[model samples]
Target: MAHLPQVLVFGPPTIFTQFEPQYSHKYHFLNAWASSLPLDQFLHTHNYEPSSIQAILCAGGGTPVTVHVLSVLSSVKLIVTTSAGLDHIDLLECRRRGIQVAGAGSLFSEEVAEMAVGLLIDAMRKISAADRYVRQRVHSGPWDFPLGSKLGGKRVGIVGLGSIGFEVAKRLEAFGCSIFYNSRKEKPFISYPFYSSVVELAANSNALVICCALTEQTRHIINKEVLLALGKEGVMVNIGRGALVDEKELVRCLIEGEIGGAGLDVFENEPHVPEELFGLDNVVLSPHAAALLKSLPLICVTLWQGI
Candidate 1:
């Protein structure tokens, strides 16, 4: 027991609790820290006596772990995250501090992909709008809403063909959609048609879905030009980072009818969506719950064990 390493985890309590039953006797699990805690307070409580800690794990929301926090815990060897996304962590700082960082890849890919497909279908078929009408008891109006478009035989464009993007393409294929993709590099295993640029893909497809990672290079990649290319007949779905799409441009596009509609599970400024979006009936929005499912607890526990 004395030889085991002490690992401090900063995230939800459930993450540590679920995994503790399996590995508690082997390693020490320190008190959990919420992501909302100030960095200074977090460090004061968790790393004040840094000698007792040998590793750190960040498993909460997309908060950047500052270099100052890393500097205080010089003895920490590795940092493990339960999420597949790494944009929240400072990779350069970790490399400079010689702290290894490992993330869960492909673990949440299918979950996110399924959510994207669901949003796409809802947007195309106006499911949310229909549900709203029923709840409001607007029964007097004739059922003359514009006909819904079928996903079959439509040109579907996918941005970023990583694990999640591939999964989305596979599922969309079941509906007989012709898949097209744009990525930094082409994948040989994917049988879909490839586009060299996002603009071209948006201009050609009936639906455009964003599944790319959030990075300096990809920030606001889907701006006004891309939306304009995806004219009023085209629909858009974003299950990726909200920063990947320009919120201002999206709002303007939706208001001006430049594009048909959008299905969004994330936003540029999370937990604080723009007030203007609430009035638009064309958009379907969620509070970043795409990756959260009943299976998340089990998957998170499995990832903790491997970490």
Candidate 2:
């Protein structure tokens, strides 16, 4: 009988372990966390048979795929991640080492885009707020509820024109939104007005849907200046990673009415949202559960094949 190819796994079991029952018969997964031997010791034992360790599987942003980790497993040529964002992986090191990487790609884009749009509308329309108002039994005299801004004719700016961002643009266009985008560079095929600077994008937009990847260059991309550009009437929806926006600055802006409103699905710190946002009605919050794809398990089934 032939032995299955070896794969080194590192992440919380909830993520990496889900694939175990499906792929156990097909491959050998060496879970780093389950090993009594330290990860360094485990890799050292494979020095002579480095090629046996051909793949490393990591949870999208849960585990850090540092250069050191890659270097230790010298012969690993492929990395399969369960998430769309690669911010957690050291791409520079992967490039230098000539290792290939693949992510969930377009499979996760539609769902995330849906969440982004939902948040955008909720921020603009105050759906969550209205729901809370009803639940809290605030039905009195005049039923004084502020009117939600209409979706039609709103100028929207998408920070990244990637798969998820493109999907968002398509959906919003159906609702009569004018789509503009700012990306690393202009994609000529796209007809939407392109801005080189996010600040400029915000200045012209009524709402900004943040779908950009989180990187060193993009960290705090939506800073105080950008928020100021977005102005007091502008709404912001962040379905992307938390660090893409300055959370502290966002909270302050929402508190001081510097910006109109915000819808946040991801946060700088997971499961720990700012208590200040809790009391604000203008801000809509989602528990980062928006993109937990229903098809995720199927991805694990075909993961090895995709690589």
Candidate 3:
């Protein structure tokens, strides 16, 4: 009998349902936590024959599973992923194993950028607080929520002007906001003012939007210093990795009014937000669902074909 090429997938089943819907039956899926996975036990229990597995796919964030599975599947030919961040993938290991890795480039960039804009606007306008007030039947009198700043006249700073950050700048440009960016290398194509450092960006702009990729160099890049630079009048928005921001410092800054407000889609410890931020009216929180949109399925299909 001819051997069927075996593919192993480690991620949400929904990605497979979206990417290879018709060919789903051809692959074997071992759904495991993106960050935490017991590789030895999982392999022993499932009888995972590494030699038989031809390809592996990691759809979620981080490099843990990619490292674990690639260490075992030395002969696997391909490592396909839907996520753009490869910090979770061990490229060195893949190179050593002769495994080719592919990913979606800017497919989800616009989607994530749009969410970042939404979070910024929501935070500035206190949309969540207004919604809560309405929900709690506090509408007996005239609504007195203070008017928010308009994006058109404000100085907007974007950290790490990569794919998503560039898209965010383009979108914010339509609102007439003056855009400033901070990246290691200045983008040749963009004409916007560039800051050499994150603190410089924070110091100049009224609102700071973080859309950088998370890496060893960028982990917890936004700390108390950056927050203090933002000052009490500035608003902060993070659509990037939670690890990029210091959560404890953020709570301290917010509580002490060091910064005006914040909108966060991703937290340092996800699904479990800091209890201190719960009662604060200036904060708008999301459950790391910024990248998840209705168009994600179509985007996944497009990325698969490109790979």
Off by over 4 Å in 1: 1-36, 45-53, 59-61, 138-146
- Better structure of 1 and 3 per TM-score: 3
lDDT of 3 by residue, 16-41 (tens): 65656565555555544342547666
Each candidate: RMSD: 3.0, 3.9, 2.8
Which pairs of residues collide in candidate 2?
none
Question: Per-residue alpha-carbon lDDT of model 2 for 217-303, expressed as tens digits?
Answer: 999999999999999999999988889999999999999999999999888876579999999988999877566655666666676
Q: Write the per-residue lDDT of candidate 1 for residues 19-77, one digit (tens) a residue.
A: 56778777876654654566556657655456667777775354456677677667877
Ranking of all predicted structures according to TM-score, beginning with the best and ending with the worst: 3, 1, 2
lDDT of 2 at 265: 89
User: How many times do residue backbones clash in model 3?
Assistant: 2
Between candidates 1 and 2, the one scoring higher on lDDT is 2
The estimated TM-scores of all candidates read 0.86, 0.83, 0.88
Which pairs of residues have clashing backbones in candidate 3? Answer: 62-88, 63-88
